[model samples]
Target: MATILYARVSTSEQTLSHQQTQAEAAGFTFDHVLADHGVSGVAVKMKDRPEGRRLFDMLRPGDTLVVRWVDRLGRNYEDVTDTIREFMRRGVTIRTIINGMVFDGQAKDPMSAAVRDALVGFMAAMAQAQAEATKEAQKAGIAAAKAKGGEEGGVYRGRKPSFTADQVAAVRDLLGKGLGVAEVSRSTGLSRQTIYRIKDDPAGASKALEVWA
Candidate 1:
């Protein structure tokens, strides 16, 4: 009978507290809060994330799971739909704050059930499509930046990087999770400009470290 709030935070703007506040503003109260920080909803399945896995185990029949949106439940279309259906099957009510949508496996008629299922599929597909579009946009930006860098010069070794190898690795990992430059900079204690450089040409950043060493 408990209610839990789950959040997936990947950017500077989408803090866990921010999500909790959004849910509260929507008039949903939760007994517990769970979050996965710096985790990409597009790249990592919920079951694979540390807190996400805990969420699966913590929730029981009759418990309500609340999220800002359906996208918080999974990495993509199939994952989102399957996870929701599985939760519904478990008798755990799934609620989204955005549309105040509820999926409780309580449809009395086949038409209602079909409509619900269709909506779930549509939302999941949209979530995945949005993720893909963002990723592609990022890739295009990186390519353009890298090309510009190459045009500036090819063999000219720049100044030594301020980041250590570990810092570089952390930057890459955070970037891979789709974190913005400011968020990645804050996480790694690096400057925004350095993070942007890494984001633009990660290989070049690594090469700088190698050439300096």
Candidate 2:
């Protein structure tokens, strides 16, 4: 059993470092860190993400799972509860950075169990509600922008670009030509880590490039 940290951000522009720092500051030492970038909790289920799947597979009995909040589990009340319960049933402990919430299946006392369950239910519901409100607010903003002839929307610059397709492709071509990752990085101005990733999984690299591009 291990201690695992799962961090997620809706956009690539947002880094997981902040969440990681919080978890570490809270005295959690993660043996593994799973992160999902550019994946929205409002639109994506926890078990559906690439990194999320690995979290489920890697977690074991007696292991502890940490997230920034209950929202990281899901954007819906039922979904969050179901996911948390499933992990608990498997003997995995769940903890959240916010409020230092802890949920474990090992709570044997009836009152303690009830209190924990109720807290989970309340927090999960609030997470879902917050996500819904955020979605509604975004829609309202978009509608208001349209009414204003897209002027307001145009004024709001979106997330910063993390990677580009041409850069990825250049790295791929260099790797295919037997160039070292460091050499590819020097040529394309991308990091050696990015080049190694492209070399390791060209298909996934292509998909990321397409989505980000």
Candidate 3:
């Protein structure tokens, strides 16, 4: 019965605020907002992310799940389709603001259902193709870097971390001390919502911290 907006930025340098602004412009009032900062859609599956996992637990039947695109659900075809279909089967309505596309499992008409299914398949395939292309591009870039010497190509110039190592360690310490998320947020400068996410999935938070390091 509520509208939820899920936004993701591959790096800390990238802002989810732009995505939020777009979602708001699309007339979606988010009752809950979940985001994954410094998380790559290509490497992290929806179910594997910190906030992403929480989303699966929080979404309910009749709730509207909005994302920037189908790609936000996954990095490839199979993952994207499977995730969306699973949500639909659970009676959750899925919508994409980018294309103004809506998918619902409650459709009773056979023809409409067929069309929707086909569209999902197409989008899923496109997502996979896009990922493949990006991988190839990265490989090519690395090769070029190697040719020029290890100066540019040795390090993967990937997503930037939202928090520094020191900050992450502090967050972990506060969480380990069993401080409430709100209290942890107040103690640290991080948002209370983000603190709740770290508390909910300490393992994922640890992995994220490793990535930061």
lDDT of 3 by residue, 1-213 (tens): 888888876643456788889899988898998887656677678899888899899888999999998877777676778888888988999999988999989878999889999999999888778879988998898777666656645544334445556666788898888886657778888765456456556676667667556
Evaluated at residue 25, the lDDT of candidate 1 is 95
Q: Which residue segments of model 1 deviate by more than 4 Å?
A: 154-213
What would the TM-scores of all predictions be? Answer: 0.73, 0.71, 0.70
- Would you list the clashing residue pairs of candidate 3? none
lDDT of 2 at 184: 83
Tens digit of per-residue lDDT, candidate 1, span 1-213 = 999999987655567778999999999887999887666787788899888899889888999999989887865888799889988999889999998988888888999999999999998998898888988998887777768779987534456688888999999998889887779878999766567667768898889999888
Clashes of 3: 0
Q: 63-170, model 2: which lDDT tens digit per residue?
A: 999998988777778878888998999999999998887898988999988998999899888988998897899988877766675665543323333457778778
Q: Give me the runs in candidate 3 sitting further than 4 Å from their true place.
A: 150-213
Q: Rate the local accuracy (lDDT) of all candidates.
A: 0.84, 0.79, 0.78
lDDT of candidate model 1 versus the reference: 0.84
Q: For candidate 3, what is the lDDT?
A: 0.78
The candidate that achieves the highest lDDT relative to the unseen native structure = 1
